[model samples]
Target: MNRLSDKEAIDLLKHGDILELGQQANKIRQEKHPGNTVTFIVDRNINYTNVCLNECRFCAFFRRENRKDAYLLPIETILQKVKETQEAGGTQVMLQGGLHPSLPFEYYLNMINTIKTAFPDIVIHSFSPAEILHFSKIANKSIKETLQDLRSAGLASLPGGGAEILVDRVRKIVSPKKIMTDDWLKVMETAHSIGMESTATMVLGLGETIEERIEHMRRVRDLQDKTGGFRAFIMWTFQPGNTQLGGNKLSSWEYLKTLAVSRLYFDNISHIQGSWVTQGQQIGQITLAFGADDLGSIMLEENVVRAAGTAYQMSIDKMVNTIEKADFKAAQRDTEYNIIRRF
Candidate 1:
């Protein structure tokens, strides 16, 4: 059967015919990866600073520069986190932080270089579209130049945060200060044009229309069509706890339905992630049967989602058992989404 389009997707979504969507997407999932094995990364999120200038309504992680807990995480603390990640058998360190307005471009370059200099093997998958855009504007440099500099300093990839929803309508409402949809796409395209690959993510249940949700997928699909640099597409319900954009959490069924629709709709993208951080391990495991090929990460340490008061606990053994209970094999992967070890 042919996969559904926008209106068809809306119909499936409304009818909650997620099983049908799952069947359609699972066909493709099996076609691409024919096995019970699901992949995850051994990574830690090293939030360099919580001090942010663009305080989006949906974010509870960022604080003012002078706030009590806000900090720039002097390079030493970041290195310590990286060391801790490595000690725990982590292969990647996600260096995600806020858009600190006063930090110079050299600050970031030095941070990347310093980390790379110490732990040459750790994959430095850092920054989001918003950070990149901010870097471009603050450093008075071109986007290409900024990305290239980071790459040269040993940044491996970009985590696709700040892409809450691609439609300007929702973007303006939630994240007025963050980069526009076009600028976000442009950064990814430019990064891919060089040699870097990245992931695409969406945070749902933030007052966007169903059409807007599908449009978000369309934008990601279109960009993937152009740059083939997306390693996987991840979707999770937005955690609205301590932020200005307070709302009810989207149900697991709604998240799973949209995830299945994303798989069925975006043919070019190969991987979809099951976010245990926000969805809990049970549904995260169920996501595999629902068309997700990867189970996100064994985040040794995480703060952003934890700050939202929605965190799940999992060690490698627990992660493996969770997937096997769901009747899938569990595997470990690196930053590039490449399988390193299978269990």
Candidate 2:
């Protein structure tokens, strides 16, 4: 295939035939992976607090600091969840939360230290760019200094949340109070510079133009060209059930088409994750043929998407079966996308 330009990507997204897109994407997936193995991680998403200061219009997961339901999970409760995840054979914990108004920067540092101190083996893939930026502002530090401190405190990697769309125009409408496009990229760039690798994500169907969708991918692709720190790229449709920015969900066809295009466009990035949590099991299964090499996680728990009124659960056996039925060998992977065991 010729080099995929921005105009070309948008054109395909707008008018590509579904099967053709999948075929082209699957061809790339075969070349990139060169095997019948599809990977998943056994992990849990633990939200420490839901008290956010920057209440984005697209979020249903955050509450004002003094709201009746607002909360910060006690350290004991957090540790207990970690214990449960460890007992369940989970290898990683995704510790993401809302931006609490008054939580000292030390609170996050100690949270990382506490988890590492207890579960030294667990990969603490925690925090989004927004949270890190918030931490820097509250603590009067630079983004680099903040990430360095978290790394010292045992932050293993970053979960690519908070990157709705990299276009400032879409950002202004959806999440004006949150960090803008440049700040999000700067956070990822800084993290990469400090030797802490992370993933990049796009939450589509936020009323962005087809051109804007490709624009988001282009920014990530350009950055990956420079830093090579982005280990994978994950794209999911925006869930708009209970949020302030309520809208219809994107169709499965659109999701799969976008996923396929992403696989073809991100030629430099190694892995593309199929999101079962939001897309459901069967569609996620189809993603293997649509250019996804990984089936994402058997999330022990997920609340953010749940808050948006779409929830799907998968046990380890179910995850294995989904891949098996799709004609690929199922393998458990770690945070770095290394296959740990095959089923």
Task: Name the top TM-score candidate.
Answer: 2
TM per candidate comes to: 0.97, 0.99
Query: Which residue ranges in model 2 land beyond 4 Å of their true spot?
Result: none
Question: Per-residue error at 221 for model 1, in Å?
Answer: 0.7
lDDT of 2 at 161: 90
CA lDDT, every model vs. true structure = 0.88, 0.93
Tens digit per residue, CA lDDT, model 1, 190-292: 9999989999999899899888998898889889989899989999999998989999999999999888888888788888888898999888987887789
Show the lowest summed lDDT stretch of 10 residues, model 1. 1-10
Expressed as tens digits, the lDDT of each residue in 195-219 for candidate 2 is 8999999998999989899999999
For residue 262, give model 2's deviation from the true position in Å. Answer: 0.4
Clashing pairs in 2: none
